[model samples]
Target chain A: GESVGLHLPTLSVQEGDNSIINCAYSNSASDYFIWYKQESGKGPQFIIDIRSNMDKRQGQRVTVLLNKTVKHLSLQIAATQPGDSAVYFCAENKGGSQGNLIFGKGTKLSVKP
Target chain B: DVKVTQSSRYLVKRTGEKVFLECVQDMDHENMFWYRQDPGLGLRLIYFSYDVKMKEKGDIPEGYSVSREKKERFSLILESASTNQTSMYLCASSLGGSRADTQYFGPGTRLTVL
Candidate 1:
């Protein structure tokens, strides 16, 4: 069955260090992928997104890398801060649908200051 | 900014009671969705609507129903709430397009069915 999954359940990182979170998707037809950050008691916030045509996209302090051949996706945060501690989720849109997203079980990121 | 607002941040409901979760978006997005978030489980789609009065069942729609009578509002209904239905319900909306639009999410509704 087609699904999206994370590689880790929890991640502890030191402040000012780099953080990497990985995701694996089973649907090859998925053309769009996005990363979201969720703080406690809040909705998931969109961080970055990448289309299948692009392999990598960068934001202010975040980067999203997509690998189509392996059906893998990764989100990287540079200079992790305490504010960056939250659960991260990866979502995929398989197209043909009305822009609905399939989200993965989140990976909790803890930045130690 | 696309603002999605849920009616309640936290709700407590008794078992077997009908529960309604309301969501409204100010962006006039054409696509609206209902999803439930649970521990160890990702966001499971319950239902979505592309246009007013037009809805589609998502991955998990067995115990839930949705209403989109207006373009700005989408509602999730729990016919008979159960303990297993206790979870975070999230609402989101996006411009109708070819999977390129980003979804704007509302602050989830944490429902506790006891």
Candidate 2:
């Protein structure tokens, strides 16, 4: 069975520091990956995404790195703030046009001021 | 922005009772999905519909069914709710396309079956 997993269940960082959340997926055929942020009592929101062909993609203050060979994915947040505290999940598109996502166990990120 | 809304923010039901969770999307997307989130399980897909009157079983579909009578609405039905069904249910929608399609999720419904 294909599965996605995170290396750390929780991560804490001080404000103004950089944070990195790592994820590993077992499905080699998965070509699309996305990072989502879920705050307390809210639905998960899309943060950034990357295709298998791309090694990395940059957003406003976040970046997603994809290492296809190792089936590893990471999200990097620069200058973490208290507002950045949330549960981060990495998902993979398994069936292409089917549009179903396989989500990894979330990594709870806490940014203390 | 894409807007997805669920019928309830929280619900409580007894065992053996029937339950329905409704979801609506204003984006006119072709794909709608129902997922349940647990403490350590993250999000697990229960069911999904790609078009009206069309549906498919996801990774976890036992004891659950879905209805897609209209394009904008998707409903999840529990024939007989149980305490094991208590969890946060999330509804999401996305455009129909390749794997790159981004899904937009609604505020989840927390159901407690006692």
Compute the lDDT of residue A82 as modeled in candidate 2.
96
lDDT of 1 by residue, A74-106 (tens): 999999999999899898985678897778888
Q: For model 2, how does the per-residue alpha-carbon lDDT over B1-114 read when each residue is reduced to its tens digit?
A: 999999999999999999999999999899999999988678999999999999999889999999999999999999999999999999999997655578899999999999
| Best-performing candidate as measured by DockQ | 1
Query: Any residue pairs clashing in model 2, and if so which?
Result: none
Question: Model 2, A69: alpha-carbon shift in Å?
Answer: 1.3
Cα lDDT tens digits, model 2, A1-113, are 11235343778999999999999987999988889999999999999999888999999999999999899999999999999998898999976657888888788899988
* CA lDDT of every candidate: 0.90, 0.91
RMSD of each: 2.5, 2.5
For model 1, name the residue pairs that clash.
Answer: none
Q: What is the lDDT, from 0 to 100, of the residue B52 in candidate 1?
A: 97
TM-score of each: 0.94, 0.94
Candidate 1 structure quality by residue, lDDT tens digits, B21-84: 9999999899999998877677889999999999999998998988998999999999999999
